[model samples]
Target: MVKYNCYKPKTEIICSGSSEDVVGQYYQDVGRSDSQGDVDITIGEALQATALTSGEKPVEWSDAAAIHEAEVRATGRKTIMPDGITAAAQSAATRNARTTRDEDKTKLGEVLSNASTKLASDKGATRGDAESVMSVEKRDDPNFTTHPAGVATSIAAAVRLNRRQRPG
Candidate 1:
């Protein structure tokens, strides 16, 4: 059988807001310059609000410490009740764990292996294809038909090539 719990608000509460958020807004509204007065007013307001909401009076001065002690005693939590478990729940959890355990690791290994095989095949195909591709026809290195000597020959060859390529 499955059990479901209903949610209910807490009876006891502590206003754990930052002193700045509480006191700052309070002082700004009260226009208080002194920090002590600001703190006093803020606490008083908090106590009043808590009292009104809980339908109880603030702790008396003499019993304040004892009240706080009692609060502290009642406050702490324990791992008292263990979480619910069922056979179906356990099986679902186990299945999820099994799927997640080596999932990414296995996927990563498969991806890397596939990538390595593809790269090897690509490299072999590229090398073989490159071997068949005709080499660039090596232009006769600066034939220097005119004045076949030094700088003059190279310049003449270059000018001839340019003139041939360019429209007249």
Candidate 2:
């Protein structure tokens, strides 16, 4: 997140009399004594300088924090850092993560494509053959069913089954 000084035209009632009234307006620069318009905006908005367009993705806070840490390590001068530096780092981190995820997805797609091609080649393969191929893949890749969410889901199911089997 970022803090921005939001300023609007300051208005004043110059005169308040029975016969006539006068008004004045002027724009106040940021950090002026009478300008007290501060707003908090998300990092994405600060970096983009506008609302997200269609199909545009926003930066995640975790990515920003990671980028900030990396910049601090690289520069060795952490204090009084400019917002531009933070914004640029955050943008870079987001792009890097996106690129990495896309690459991983492509790899997974290729694996799936190869698996399907193999299955299609076996024109008379039975359902058991498909199961055998899946078991082999799972055995080869330890991470195949070890995702955090998958582990948690299996744990929850086990707990539920244990409770159902408990003695009354």
Winning model by TM-score: 2
- Which candidate comes out best when scored by lDDT? 2
Residue-level lDDT tens digits of model 2 in 49-103: 2111211233333323422332232223354244334454345444655774643
Worst 10 residues of 1 by lDDT: 116-125
Candidate 1 residue pairs in clash (backbone atoms < 3 Å): none
List TM-scores for all candidates, in order: 0.14, 0.20
Residue-level lDDT tens digits of model 1 in 1-168: 121121111122223356445422111122212333321112112222222332221112212222122122222222121221112223333344456444322221121122211210111112212112111101211331211221122222333443344344
**Residue pairs with backbone atoms closer than 3 Å in model 2 (clashes):** none
Clashes of each: 0, 0
